[model samples]
Target: MKQIGVLLSKNYKLLSVAAILEVFETVNKFYATAGDELPFELNLLASHETIENQKESFGYQLQSIKDVKQLDLILIPAFTSDNMHETLQANRLCVPHLISQYNNGASIGTFCTGAFLLGASGLLNGKIATTHVDASDGFAIAFPEVNLKADRTVTQDGRLYTSGGATSSFHLLLHLVQEFCGNEMAIKIAKVFAIDMDRDKQSYFSTFQPSRNHNDELVASAQQKIESNYHDVTTIEELIKDIPSSRRNIVRRFKQVTGITPIEYLQQTRIAAAKKLLERTGQQMTEIIFNSGYSDPKAFRKVFKKSVGMTPSQYREKFQVR
Candidate 1:
């Protein structure tokens, strides 16, 4: 069993913390034994004993933050809200505590603006980190010490794992479950939650918009497109046509706003899809190749090996058949 310490604050985003808890619960169900030990030990720690009402700028309140020591993982979920004043104050309180946890050998992580807490803690200093896109420019200005990737959903740089937003918490947690436990366990939990066990950055969530605007409608639409059809043959030219932006302008804005090119984003999305297939299904390499949008088996092998540091076959043999 892994000990996960979650640090909570006043008005923290509930979904961020809830999503991670859901995954842990799924892990427990999958790993349950007949009259045996559970697979996870989650501790929710807060500054105070009283549970605080998390203001819903998005939705949900963080129920609590655990108080535990010698944790294997320390997760900082989304803030109560993204209000500058509120967030800065919340971050100030949480960052130092997270650092203390990390120094005690816990692997630190954050979801969305929670990355700001990690940034302020100095844990992400000189590390590649990601946070909510809306906070990109300001975060960059404030935490120039951290190499912030405005585009990525999650980044694992050393013992610190950082993700973008509330929904991205699912992907980040799935990634962690796969890393610590195994791909098989991760896939099982994902299936239990009715999520495609294989969805990743490459899988299509929705369409792409070129504008760097922080409007929720545009960002959500673009994210959905990326999540739903990341493997589509559609080009960036086609992606941005719906938006009032040019090709060069789109590319520049996307990189500046998200810290990645459209093509790179597409590839990562595809790779994430491949990871699910590799972990869950017993399909042959050729079958996974076709389903994940790779026309050629050799090409899929090359890309998969490069991204995951192992051949598709090897990944399955280690995680699936184990």
Candidate 2:
């Protein structure tokens, strides 16, 4: 049997851990019903020792990470919250154990913000990874050495795997199922879970929510300009025209504060507007483009496809309000 260890780390989102257990349990049940021996030994790896005294197995064996020396697979669940700085600090002791398991050829997969903990282990350095689309900015800022593929629904580098936010975890779970249990088993589980296994990208679900976590009024001023006039302003200069700072200085502070340049902020704002129009109304392409501050249809389509991972028509078809 494959030894599957799901880290019941502190601050772990309960739903994520439950989902992981549910999938593996279903896998085991599938084999057992076919009169085959159980295929997986699902173990919840807890950081503390108190779990051993508890009797809430729910069909999963809880083992202290300190006692477990080997595992074939390790699944890290999303955190209960997005404050990864504190979340990682609380789960610091699990990192060394993860690194050891990974080095010993065990595959590691993370769901949503759980990638932060995996990234903290330095295992993702130079490896392609992703987290929640909204949290992508923070993840990129925190782990500059890692290749952050924010648009990808699921990414696999060697044995390390990462997924996008929320429901994106289901896609990665299916992927791991397919990898170990074959395509047929994965598809069966997908049908049971009602997951769209063909979803290749998570970019369409993204919103351009600009950060207001910084104290720089100049940056806030630049953001105000971008948000208020994104439908008309075409240049970063226009967004900063009234701000009392040099372009270079504002650009640096903007990147430092918002994790994106003023130009990108404006582009995203325009995109957000366009997405809203497409979703809420049956707006024509040219009209939407102009209203989104773009005059060139071809340029806008290129940018839309590049950023949103789908053409405007496709996005509309998928998400248009009926």
The 0-to-1 C-alpha lDDT of every candidate, in the order given, reads 0.68, 0.89
Segments in model 2 whose C-alpha atoms lie over 4 Å from true places: 49-57
Highest lDDT against the true fold, candidate: 2
What TM-score does prediction 2 earn? 0.94
For 1-322, candidate 2 gives per-residue lDDT tens digits of: 8999988888888899888889889998999999998978888788765485763455666788777869999999999876788899899988989999988889999999999999999999999999999899998889989999999999999999999998899999999899888999999999999999889899999987788877999898888888888887678887787788899999999998888888888888899999999999987888999999999999999999999999999999999999
Stretches off by above 4 angstroms in model 1 are: 33-36, 49-67, 196-322
Q: Kindly state the number of residue pairs that clash in model 2.
A: 0
User: Per-residue lDDT for 1-322 in model 1, tens only?
Assistant: 7888776655677777778777887677666754547868877766644444332221333333334457789887877665655676744655666777788788988887887777777778899988775565557767888997776777898899987655667778878988988888777666766654443332122222233445544433444566577666656555556765566766665555555566666676777787778778888877888778778788778877766556787777766733
State which candidate has the highest TM-score: 2
* Model 2 lDDT, residue 289, Cα: 96
* Candidate 2 lDDT trough over 10 residues, lowest sum: 49-58
